[model samples]
Target chain A: MQVTLKILRFDPEKDKKAHFKSYEIEADPLDRILDALNTVKWYKDGTLTFRRSCAHGVCGSDAMRINGRNRLACKELVGDIGKKITIEPMLGFRILKDLVVDMEPFFEKYRSIKPYLINYEDPPATERFQSAEDREIFDETTKCILCGACSGSCPPFWSNSEFIGPAAIVNAHRFIFDSRDQGSDERIAVLSQSEGVFRCRTVYNCTDACPREIPVTKAIEQIKRVMLYNR
Target chain B: MYRGQSGMWLWVFHRLTGVGILAFLFLHVADTYLVGLGPEYYNELVFLYKLWVFRLAEWLLVGAVLYHAINGIRVVLMDFWESGVERHTQLVFGTLGLFLLLWLPAGIFMLKDVKWFA
Candidate 1:
C-alpha cells in the first residue's frame, strides 16, 4: 500500500516560515514510519532532514508529533497510524529545521536539577550496595530516555518556557529517591521554587506523552510530597 | 490541537470553568452591591435574571461550578494518593459521573419556576 506522509518542513536558510510538504511512498503496513521517512529523504527529496541514531527508540532521537501525539517514528508503525500521517517537530522547542528542534533548552533544564548521582562519602569497598526494596521506590522513573515527548506535550511548558519540565523532574526523582544518593535535599529545594514542581497543575500530559511509559506526573507528585513532608 | 486524550480534555474544562466561575464572581459582587444603593435598584437588576436567556446562563453557571468543584477533588486525590496516577483515567470518569449526578437535579430545581415550555 502507498502511504501519504505530510511533513512540516522548515528551511532556515531560505524560507521565512515552515510549511507542509507531502510525499506518497510505497510501504508495507508493518514498516516503521522511520522507514518511510528514509525513503522520502533518500529517494524523493535529498533536502529532507531529520535526526535518528539507534532508530530503535532507545537513543531518544527521532521524537516528533505523529498524528497529533508525541511518539518515536522508529517505534510507530504505518499500520498503527493509518495511511495518512502528519509529522511535525516536537512542541515547546525552537524548530531548527524539518522534524528537528533545538534540544539545548531542554537539556539546560535537565542539567539544572543535577541529573547525575551526588554522593560524597568514603568508598564502600568496591561499589555501593542497595536492597531491592530501596531500588523499587524510584524504579519507574529510571526508564526515562529524555525523549522530550513528555515535556513537549505539557501545556505549562508550552506557555512558560521557564517551568522546569517533567523530564527534568523524573531525572531528579531517579537520584532523589535512590538510597545510595545523598542529594535529595538540594534537589528538592531547587524543585520547590516557583518555576519548579508547583507550576505543574497535574494536567497529566507528560504522563500521556512519555514514550518510555514512565509515570511522569506521579514522580513529580512524589517530589512534591517529599518537599512538603521533609520541611 | 495537540490531540491529547481524556486528561487534556479534563484540564481544558477545569481551566475554563475556573475562569468562568471567577468571572461570575465579579459580576455577582457588582450586582449585589446594588443592594446597598436601594431596594428599587437591586430588585430591578435582579428582575432581569428571570428572563429565559439569563436562566439558561444560570444553569450553565451551576454546571460549571459543580464540575469545577468535583474535578478539584479529583486533582487533590491524585496528588496525595499512591495509586492516583495509575487510576487517573478512572478518576476522570468518576468525576464526570458525580458532576452529572449532582448538576442534573440542581438544574431541574433551578429551572422549575421558569415557564420556558409554557
Candidate 2:
C-alpha cells in the first residue's frame, strides 16, 4: 500500500521555523510507522531524522504525534491509521530536528519527582522483600519507559510548564504506593505543591496517550486520595 | 497538545459550563432574594426575567445545565471505573447523545412561551 507521510521538519541551526514536509512511500499494510520512516530516510531523503533504538515499542524512543495522537511510532501499524499520515514532533518540547524533540524538560520533570526508591534503613543481608499483593499495587506504573507520551498529550502540561505532569505523578505513585518504601511523606510534600496533582483536570488524555496502556488517570487519582487520607 | 482529542474537549466544555452555571447561580440567588424585600420589588425583578434577552439566556441555561449534568456523569464514570477510561471517547459521544436528546425537548419546551419562537 502507498501512504503519504507529512512530517514536521525543523533545524535550529538552519531553519528559523518548523515546516511540514511530505513523502510518499510504499509499504505493507501491517508495517509499523517506524518502518515507513526508515524507508523515507533511506530511499527518499537521508535528511529525515528520528530516534528509534529498539525499533520496537519497549524502548519508547520513537514516541511522536502521529495523526494528532501521541504514540510509539514503532508500535503503531500503518493500516491502523489512514492513507494519509501526518507525523510531528511531540508537543510541549523544543524540536531538535524532524520528529526529534528535546526531552530535557521532560526528563527534568521526571527527575524532580525523585523516581528512585528511597529506603534509608540498614541493608538486609538477603534482599528487601515485598509480598505479592503489595508489589501488585504499584506494578502498573513501573512499566513507564520515560517516553513522555503521557506528559506530551496533557493540555495542562502544555499550558503550564510547572505542572508536575502525569509522568511525574505516575513515578511518584510507583514509590508512594509501595508498602516497603518510606519516602511517601517526602514525595507527598513534593506533590502537594500547586503545580502537582491538582493541576490535572482528569482529561484522560494521559491515559489515552500512554503507549504502555498504564492506567495513568487512575494512578493520579490514587495519589490524590493518598494525599487526602495519608497526609 | 493545545488541540486535543475528545477527552480534552470534554474537559473544556465541562469547565466552561461549570463557570457559566456558577455565574448564573449568583444572579439567580440575588434575584430570588428580592422576593423577601417586598411584593413590588419582587414583581419588578420577576419582570426582568420575562424580557426577550433574559428569555434567550434562560434557554441557554437549560442547555448548559443539561450538558453539564450529562458530561458530569461521564467525568465521574471515567474517574471511578476502569472501563470508563478505555471507553472515554465513546462515553463523550454518549454524553453528547444524551445531552442532545434531553436538551432538544427541554429547549423547545422552555422557549415555547417566547414570542420570537412562537
For DockQ, the strongest prediction is 1
State in Å the error of residue A25, model 2.
0.9
Per-model TM against the reference: 0.96, 0.84
Residue ranges of candidate 2 with Cα displaced over 4 Å: B1-6, B18-54, B69-105
Distance from true location, Cα of B76 in model 2, Å = 6.5
Going through the candidates in order, the fraction of native interface contacts each one reproduces equals 0.65, 0.38
lDDT per residue (tens digit) for residues A1-231 in model 1 = 889999999999988999999999999999999999999999999999899999998999989999999998999999989999999998899999999899999999999899988999987788799999999999999999998999999999989989999999999999999999998888888898899998888888788888888989989888887776678
For residues A169-216, write the lDDT of model 2, one tens digit per residue: 999999998987889888888889999887888888898899998999
Provide the overall lDDT of each model, using Cα atoms, as 2-decimal numbers.
0.91, 0.87
> Residue A91 CA error for candidate 1 (Å)?
1.1
lDDT of 1 by residue, B2-116 (tens): 9888888898999999999999999899899999999999999999888877898999999999999999999888777878877988998899999999999998899888878
* Candidate 1: clashing pairs of residues: none
